[model samples]
Target: MIPAASALARAGHEVLVACVPQLVEEFTSAGLKAVAALPDQAECWAEITDTGHDQVIKVVVGQRLLARGYPELRKVAAWFEPDLVLRDGMEFCGCLVAEQLGIPHVAAPSGAVNTLAPAAIAPLLNERRAEFGLDVQDDPLAIYRYGRIDSLPPRYSFAARGIPRAVAYRQPEASDRCEPLPSWITELDPGKPLVYGAIGVALPTAAASRDGGKASTIPADPVRALAALVGALSELDCTAVVSTGGVSFPRAGVPPHVRLVEHIAQPLLLQTVQLFVTHGGYNSVREAVRAGVPMVVAPLFGDQLDNARKVAELGLGEQATAPSEIAAACRKVLGSSENLARARHAQRELLALPPVDEVARRLALLASAR
Candidate 1:
């Protein structure tokens, strides 16, 4: 969203981000004007680890939080009263406010929208709408009335009925955050394949042990999962770079063949790596596709499973459910000419989409139309 907001700002839009107070600094640091729309108690939703029935609970929790913050958000909307509202898919407060103000609202792609049915969220959204003195919305996708800006290639996108109006746009590489290639990356053996592994930002933290290890509140076991992936990668004859997603693990347990870090510039690293091992988040999938890198997707939850399915269906990569299967999946994708070809094809398709500037211009036009 920072990138999208920055693009709009650069296009000359007077954008003011309405967010939690905690994130005001992040927005201001990115050169965006921001206001705290909600009180400090309205905490953000935690990461979703369970993609089953528990996902509905998570969605309800998010709606309830947005509902609680709606009064403050209404104040922000009335004060800002300029034009259309552009919100990430999960945020319903903006939609509610826009509806109240009789302005258009656009849904920006944050993840696979089709993962959760609109009907699943209608009851909660309507409840919030009633409280706001607005008409109850029967359509769950009402927030996307102005349309959406999609970054995924056609094959990677989900098939859903009643999807809102949308335009395709390419995601720019993270050049701003990228640093020069590190010494370790530069010094890697050219003769050996360079594989990169990341479980993503939402990975559960390490479990506590008798030896005084820290524990996580998240229910998922990402520590064990990450270790499995690293172990499998180490067994192969490849140089592996594994990001632990800020979760600390026993450094002594990491294999000599692997380099573990809390984080790295993935978009930049993808440029040089032969294969990417990812948790199949939409951002990671899009980046790998744009970089023309084949993948081994080990999806943990949510839209990740959908992304993994698409990767396999499109021949862009393979999927592995267990850590022990990651190496073979990587080898299979790397060795397959078809997989590489498909990845390149997807890359070309993504690159052909309109750039961010054009997307920002179109969004501005939407505001003007309203």
Candidate 2:
């Protein structure tokens, strides 16, 4: 969605993104106007349940926040009155407001909203929309559901509850989302496997893990962990693309074979890469799946650990607490011809889904309808 926002702005729309303050700069840096949609509060919690109950709880709380902030949002909207509104999937208030204003709106999922997850939470979402005097039938958006792509399920449970699923947003290889990396990453022999290691943007310290009664950064030793994984992977013939994610890697003893960058074109990087080593953020994991590549999940905080567990349970990827064992695991995944075949096969299956551009086209039509 970040990439798409830039694309929309480039297309000459006056885009005013309503989002958390921490992320406003991302849009502005990309040349779009931004508005802070929510307060900058730090909250983090562990995931003990996967029945979507937590999402329900979040929606309930978000409603209170929306009620409190509606006046401010209205003022901003009144001032901006954008030609279109795009809301991040978890943030429903913007969607509500867009509906009331009859603005062409697009919902972009910042994380995965699987069939299971969405089904469990649709009732609450529909009810919340109703309370805001908005149509629950607003277009559905399924961005970054899995693999670094966006997709909507052909249907959502909201339809069963009388909220017809609107047009969904999806794209397998949205060029606007990722910047291309150097060609050196392509040096790997296609016969030999490749791994892409990444840690996504860290969230503000979650509410539950505040330290000294204040918010603290994530505790994972990401750099050290990546180094360990690289060492383990050295024994294998595969090359590794290690993204530092705005962190600088120590240069003293770095390996030449390892390609290090702050970020890579996610969709493009996923294509040839055989395995993804990630912090298990929803977007990263889902993108990998959407691309059909397998993964090695090293969940650091919040829902990441649970996402990693699900990856392992679903026979889609492996998991480890430390990087020392990553190589052996990678080899295990490679050696199992069926697993390798399955992972690649999944990629092909997902690729068969409609690309994101088609989804965007549908959204434009729906917006016209409104």
Candidate 3:
């Protein structure tokens, strides 16, 4: 949403993001205006990180967040009187408010559309809608009443069987933001292939470890998974840069060939990396495709599995579940001329799609329409 909001602001639209107080700084840092719509709640949506929850618990949490957030968001809408509301796919408040105000609302998918299927959440959404004296929707995808702006090409989208309308826009390749690389990065052996590995920021951090209390320990599953990747990469002749996403690791245990950091500028790192080992988030996959870099995907949760499937199905890379298998998967993709060719082909496809500016122009037109 940051990229979309930035594009819209650049296109001369006055934009204000209504979000939880926890994210206000994030929006402001991106040079966008943001209001704390859910000020009372320090973090209202933390349940999203509980990946272990069953479908019923996930639905309950989604409904609970929606219910708690809508009243606050309605207050925001009344004050702001936005001509149109643009929301990430999971955020239903925008749709509800837009419906009440008779204004347009656009659904923007932050990840694969499979992650936002209306069928999965429509029953809960309609239950909430009825409490507000709104008519129930028969069509599960009515939340996307105005339209949707998709960042992926058609072949890469996991949109359901029926959607109202959609426009494809290629996300730009990750740009060099002029952030300085770590000093240690410069000292790496220049002769070996450079492989980049990251599990992304969506992983839960141990708060106890983040404080001075104790060293942060990642959940057992992720720790083992990450250990496997790091262990597998150590066997290769390549120099690997692995970002633990703040998961603490003993420095002595790390192989000399691998550099571990809490965070690294992924776009900047991808620029020169030969192969990517990723958890297959849509943005990560898109960026790797943009860079013409093949991947070895180890999906952990959510739509990551689907994204990983697409990576292999599209011939862009391979997928491995077990830590023991990741090395061979990486080796297979890295050595395959076919995978390299396919990745380059995907890059060309991405380059051919309309830019975000075009998407912004279309959104502006939608806002202005009667």
Candidate 4:
């Protein structure tokens, strides 16, 4: 999303990123005008599991966040008077705001957000629409009325039917400086393959206990999962790098074959990595695809399962859960030319699409017409 915002700003568009307080600094650091207009949603997502069955579909963002966020968004929109609204795929408030203002808006692709069933989410959003004094929309695709942007080709998309699809455009490498890789990473076992494994920051690593901040809020025990992956990677013949999202790792036994660090330049590292062991976050999957790297996907929850299934379906890699299964998958994937070929094919497709700068140009044309 930072890449998208940055692209628009570079194109001479006046962009204001309205996000929660925690993310304000990061957005401003990117050289964009950012404000803390949205509410803190940690507690909202945590309490969602107890809600009704219909409400469970869009767990992360729903009426609760919408109620708190829409007012803020409307206030900002009234003054900013944006010609077009670009929103995260999971965010519903922008859709409602666009509808109220009778303007255009587009969604950026998200792993699980695009996969949400419109039939399931329509009633939920329409309820809010009616309350806002807007006519209730019957069209399931109203949320994406102007369409959505995607890095993937149309045929390779994970979004369900009726989600207005955007033309395929290359998603940039985010262009942000990632935490530096330890200097010794390139020095290890040059003749053998290099494997990179990372579970996203949303979940807690085994080392999260040492960080002492927000680790308790994570509902699942990702530490055991991380430990299993570390254990498996330790025995593999290849050199391995695992990122623990800035938390201290392995209280004692540190193996030479593997390196556990707080962070690394993921976009750059993916280019050299022979195989990626991932928790199947979409951004990670997208980066691997852009790099033409094969994957061993072990999805923990949510849309990760869907993304993993898409990986397997595309012949890009294998999916596994258990540590032994992951180890087996890694060995098989590393040895397979087919997986590598498919991955490269996806990369070529991504490369063929217009770059994000060009996409920004098209978006500007659309906004001007609006």
Candidate 4, residues 1-370: lDDT per residue as tens digits?
A: 7778899999889999888887899999879899888887665656645333343455544667788889999999999999888888877788888888888888888777766778778877777887778899888778777878988877667776667767678876653466655578758888999999998766754236335554224544566667877887877899999987764456467587788877788898888899999988888888898899999998777777778878888898999865678888899999999999999998888888888887788778888888
Q: Candidate 4, which segments miss by more than 4 Å at Cα?
A: 50-61, 175-181, 205-216
lDDT of 1: 0.76
For each candidate, what TM-score against the reference? Answer: 0.89, 0.65, 0.88, 0.91
Best TM-score among the predictions, by candidate number: 4
Model 2 Cα lDDT, one tens digit per residue, 235-305: 67777777776564675665766767777788788877778877778777657766777877776655576
User: What is candidate 3's lDDT per residue for 25-106, written digit by digit as tens?
Assistant: 9999989999988533213323344333244235432556667778888988888889999887756777888888889999
Error of 4 at 257 (Å): 1.1
Candidate 2 deviant stretches above 4 angstroms = 2-15, 28-33, 41-69, 79-86, 95-106, 112-180, 183-192, 203-216, 234-237, 248-266, 286-292, 313-315, 321-325, 364-370
- Number of the top lDDT candidate: 4
| Per-residue alpha-carbon lDDT of candidate 1 for residues 286-368, written as tens digits (9 for 90 to 100) | 88988999999998776787778778988889999766788889888878999889889989988888888888888888788
Ranking by TM-score: 4, 1, 3, 2
Candidate 3 vs. true structure, TM-score? 0.88
Worst 10 residues of 4 by lDDT: 206-215
Q: What is the C-alpha local distance difference test score of each model?
A: 0.76, 0.60, 0.76, 0.80
List RMSD in Å for every model shown: 3.4, 6.6, 3.4, 2.7
Q: Rank the candidates by lDDT, best first.
A: 4, 3, 1, 2
lDDT of 4 at 85: 86
Candidate 1 worst ten-residue window by lDDT:
206-215
